[model samples]
Target: MQIRDLPYADPGVPDVRSGTRFLLWLGRQQLGGQVKCLLWGLLHHLGIAGLPLGVGLAVQAVVDRDGGRLALAGVLLLALGAAIAAGDVMLHRTAVTNWITAAARVQQLLSRKTAELGSVLTRRVAAGEVVAVSTGDVERIGWFVEALSRFAAAAVTLVVICVGLVVYQPALGVVVAAGIPVLALAVLPLLPHAARRADVQREKAGKATELASDTVAGLRVLRGIGGEELFLGRYRAASQEVRRAAVHSARMWALIAAIQVVLPGLLLIAVVAYGTKLALDGRIEVGELVTVYSAVALTHHALRNFEEIAQAFSFSRPSAKRAARVLSLTRTTTTVPKPREVEAGGDLYDPLTGLRAPAGLFTAVVCGDPDVAGRLADRLGGHPTEPDADHTSVLLGGVPLDELPLEDARTVVLVQDKEPVLLSGTLRELLDVPTSGKVRAEHALAAAQCDDVLDALAQASVATGGDPMLTRITERGRSLSGGQRQRLALARSLFADPEVLVLDEPTSAVDAHTEAAVATWIAELRRTRTTVVLTSSPLVLDRAHCVVLVHEGQAVAVGSHRGLLATEPRYRAVVTRETDEELATADGRAVELDALEGESA
Candidate 1:
């Protein structure tokens, strides 16, 4: 189907309005190629069927002692042989082009859908399903679309040959016509059962792929928790299930293949048996009888093409349905929209969680549950909504978060996490990422205390873009340690210097001394700007102007760290692993944090 029309297409299968209609639309797009392939296939089949007639004619001509007629028949046979060769070449070329074009059309539709949905794609569909649709499914769909054209051509050629035989020898023509239908119809029953089994096998394959992807993505974490073997066992079991399904599907296909061969042979036997009887009865001449028998043999070849078409359709239908499902996601109505009129200056508000970041202030969000905090971070980042999801309105200057154009919202809100990504590159390249001229690379590196990180990179001679200082990274930056990656990500975000910066445990992976230094630097750099830090670490919390403790997805308390410690037991319990540590060191250990506040000011 056309890419423009894909968005309006339906995905709910088992209905005529969805997958079937999409396939029909795709077929119509290449109707011209289909027509050409059909015509070529017809020419090829006719050339084959004519060979036997030519031989019979030559025999009769030689029997009558007519050398001129024999020579003419020989010339005609040579012409037919050339025509067959030419048609065979054209048939294959046109058919392959038609198939490839159909596959390309489907691929375009899928790619367009991916662009429309953006980050929501992963949340809506499995990553492996997308992979499968892009590759295996597209090829199968093209095959079926091309088969439809050849199927028509083959059937028509069969009919034309049979009609010609009947006119020449009605008895032979009748026998062939009867036997061809039986040969073609024999596979129909097995088709339904085979298709069902194939669908099951495809599902199992998708699961196996999904499991493998998940296992690889989580391999690091699995190793950390000693769960590698457990996951490996689960994946092995899933692979076995896939094998079982494949075996079942193969059995059904093999049975259909056996019938495809056996049924045609039975028809051949009938033709030879009946033709022998007629020849014996003297109702047909020896030459005509031989021609009739030859026509029967050629018809068998034509019938075999029908079996190929059947198998192609069986595979293609399900593939088309899956592609339709992926394309259909573009039509979903869930989308975030920006507001019409807005205040230039106000606090950012989140209605879902009743959280607000006041303008030009540092606010720390300490969530007792880290999972909720991560989800909240995603919701704030202008990413797609999860299915059956919950979200509060994140407002900027009293403007609803959803109402901000995605680009503008992204310009205003930036989320930096402790485990920031270190794409393959030099330390300078990582800091200068997003490459916008707004924030200088040196400035971001200084703010994130990345001097030592750069030194480490130099020592290792890492390069990303062939620049010794900008070399590429392997997948997922496996070369860097947890703390190094986090600092690099923070540097990149700082380079953006958005209006509101949200850092989630940005110093959690670093050592206590590094965490204290980063927390102090972050405070100094973000002074007089709106900075919301989501953290449970005492190091970062001690630097915030205000700390808001979130418990069970709600703001339970809001105050400075010392104020919360004196007033809110829940806040004290969350931020401090040892509540008595403060008390144990309290005697003659009063330390003033006023200098840190003054440094920010």
Candidate 2:
């Protein structure tokens, strides 16, 4: 594969059963590249292996004072050099390509899975683990994947070099051949300890990353609660643990490196010593002794490849396991995809809670428990947050949402999640998503009271000549205030203008005035559209045409806001928990919320 086609259109379903299997799957994906590397590597090592023979021929030719033999030796050296250069260049080229392609494939798979799972991915897998995989693990996996081919070629080259030596000068060739193989095998026993140390280092590093991620995510909350230093100290300790584990792992690898170096040097010395004695005793010629010494030195290069292979695998094994663990997380699917569609203007019914909101009605659902309301919002949109497979699909217009295709279900019933994310992009891009196109951008912004946010962003984008629509928002809208972010998210959701919109505490972060304005505008803009708002706010309840009081995961009562306050004691307890003033009559309650108006059908 070329660099331009780096990211595959479809990375294909990976075998995420285990880390080793995932690694094998990656290897299988790029078989052509691996074979190319192996062939190139074989050619390269063969050229290096031929060097001792060329040198020995030259020495013998000079000793015999033969011009023709000297010329032949010169020609052999030239051919060997060419082979080495060509093989080295192509081998490096193919190995790097394999590394980059493998990394890109892994990144693509992770990206697709993340998108498929959405925010629930973070809930299922640790954010730290995901970050580590994306940032560090991809490189490690690519590294070992590329190393395998070169290691295989080196192994084959070692065998060929040994056979050639034994055939050229049997006595000294046997010693050189046996010594090289022994040196290659010397580092194998140290590998298991190195791998164990590396695993410990990886585990500690993952925990440190997790702690750091958590600390940064909650920095604002920690500051508010005067707990910043507490988290900071914990992270510092975690990072120190990571450092200690890394150092320990490093020592083990250093020992392995020493063994690889020392063992090969000792083998080379033994070959030279034994070859010199044989040459002196006239058992082997001087030219033959030189060739044996040179050939044994060349084998050190081949032996190094074995050590490299061991090190690469030791580091990458744990990384592969981590990546596999992250990808193995599967969400419980409540909906089985079926090619179906639901008609507009259908009542939303959650069978488990016995809650039903009438069609085309602006309804407010007040739950005493905020957590229950969040889950109920998910259920309304065929996205269940709970682990219970016992949940039946919430029906829209007498049709089970589970039967409809996910796209169809989401298109018809939109859920403006409790924490709506604003990805970093221009304001226009943020609002540019699949929509019914019934609501204009300006209208959605006005209804959600986003004029202040627009004004600020426009001012900030002075380089763009004061165009707020072209202004770039930071990730998660971090640059904006919490209330502004909430409002902008609401505006975007409103712009989509789905058939049935379900919003969970959309105005919870806003001030009383802004919340009241948003509640009023939302009701007016969504008129004749099926809308459900889960809120305990009286301002939002005042404008809602129908209000349902949910207590302990059940729909206890349903009525107008003022009627519920007047007759339903349980509803009043939930809604007025913050402000427990008793409104004696319906007229009094209406007077209290005189500024807010109900939706004009």
Candidate 3:
């Protein structure tokens, strides 16, 4: 594919079993490009091989004083030179196209995987390793892919030259031909050591990159805690280790390069010394000796190509393996057959936890442990805790959620976790998420209590002379306060207005007053739709139509805020966290009020 046509129509499935298979798969994907590269490379190298024959013929014609033959040889030399120049230009163009296309394909695969896995991707792979694979590892893979065609052409050209040498002068040709294999294979013994060093260097570099990324991401927290110098020192140590590993890797490669040069030079010397003896003894003509000598020099160039192929393979193998590892990660959940569209606003139920959010109700789940609450929230949205957790399914409107297509499932239930990400973009761009369009941006923002955030953004925009909606947000909204970012994310989720909304600790980052306001507005806003909030906050829980108290991974009690306070001790402790006297007063008041109202009736 051309650079402009990128983001391929389909980045076909790859073979991820091994690095070698992945590289071969890439070759097959860009077969046409590879073929063109090989053809042009062959033409270029063949043209260079022809030069010696032209010069040899010219020398013979000159010695015989045949002007006509000399002129013919001159024409042949000119044609070969022109062919070499043309082939060189085209070969370079095709090779570059191959390189860019390969890298683009790998990048596309990485991007698709990232989108599919979402936050779970970082849990499975290190953030730094992903970055390294997408950037440097991709280039290494492309380099090896593009180098393959040239290596093939070089091998073919070497063989042709050897055969011609043998036909022209057998004794010297045999010596040169035999030496060529030794020269090419001389560096094989050092490759294992070189590759091991390269792997070490790559590992160190990934760690250093990950360290830098983590440090930058948490720079604000570090500075607040007076730990900036500690992190900086750690990063310095990682950088130094990376440098040491790189130096060791480079030393091994440098030794291989020296061998590459020395072995070819020795082969050339052997050819020349042996050819000279043949010429002096009248066993070979002067022109033939010159021809053999030129061929040997050209053969050295071919041998260098062999060394480059070996080096490229050594470096790219690990990169390709890393890429394959990422590509091989398929979703563990079984993909069910697609069904017709189902109605929205269904009752969400998780069989594993036996927690149910009835249709069009505001249900609050209070768990003693936050992690258990989070897991329940995930299951409520048809997101299985494990890939093999299909047997435990969440049902929507009596249909097993795992049976629904991913997109349909998302439309039915949207889960907003505690730490939702806000991508860098304008305010409008951020709010322009996939939605049912029932809730307007203004209404959603107001419901999420983001008026202050909007006012801040508007003032900043005014100072910068831009529209409030067009105000640019920094990465992850880092420039905004924690509460501001949280509110913005909540606003975005509210704007989606899905059939079922599962919010996990949505108001944890806000103050009590703001939390109360958000709790009130959210109930009012989602009154017509099903909403499940996983929280232990009294304000949010009190506002829910019903509260389910989850204890030890199971829903132990379900009732209203007042009823739960009077009945379930666990629920009261989770929501109020009060002392014995305070708990007695609250529970007595709730029970006495209920009894007094009952007596009046």
Q: List lDDT for all candidates, in order.
A: 0.75, 0.86, 0.86
TM-score of every candidate:
0.76, 0.89, 0.92
TM-score of candidate 3 versus the correct structure, residues matched by position: 0.92
Q: For model 1, how does the per-residue alpha-carbon lDDT over 388-441 read when each residue is reduced to its tens digit? A: 255445677877656776556656777764455565655555555443465677
- Candidate 2, residues 1-601: lDDT per residue as tens digits? 8667867988888888888899989999999999999999999999998998899999999999999999999999999999999999999999999999999999998987786556667767888999999989999999989998999999999999888888988887787677776778877888899899999989999888988887887677788999988988898898899899999989988887888788778877887888778888889888888887888778877777898888889888999998888777643356465557788888999887888988888999999888899888877877666656565778988988878765677688888877888999999999998999788999999999998998999899988999999999988888898889899999998999998999999999999999999999988999979899999999999999999998887898989999998878778878887334453464466765664544332
| Residue range with the least summed lDDT across 10 consecutive positions in model 3 | 330-339
Q: Against the correct fold, how does model 1 do in TM-score?
A: 0.76
Arrange candidates, best TM-score first. Answer: 3, 2, 1
Root-mean-square deviation of every model = 7.1, 5.8, 3.7
Candidate 2: where is the Cα deviation over 4 Å? 222-228, 334-359, 389-413, 555-557, 566-569, 578-601
lDDT of 3 by residue, 183-262 (tens): 77889999999999988888888899999888888899999999999999999999999999989999998998898888
Once all C-alphas are superposed, what RMSD does model 2 give against the true structure?
5.8
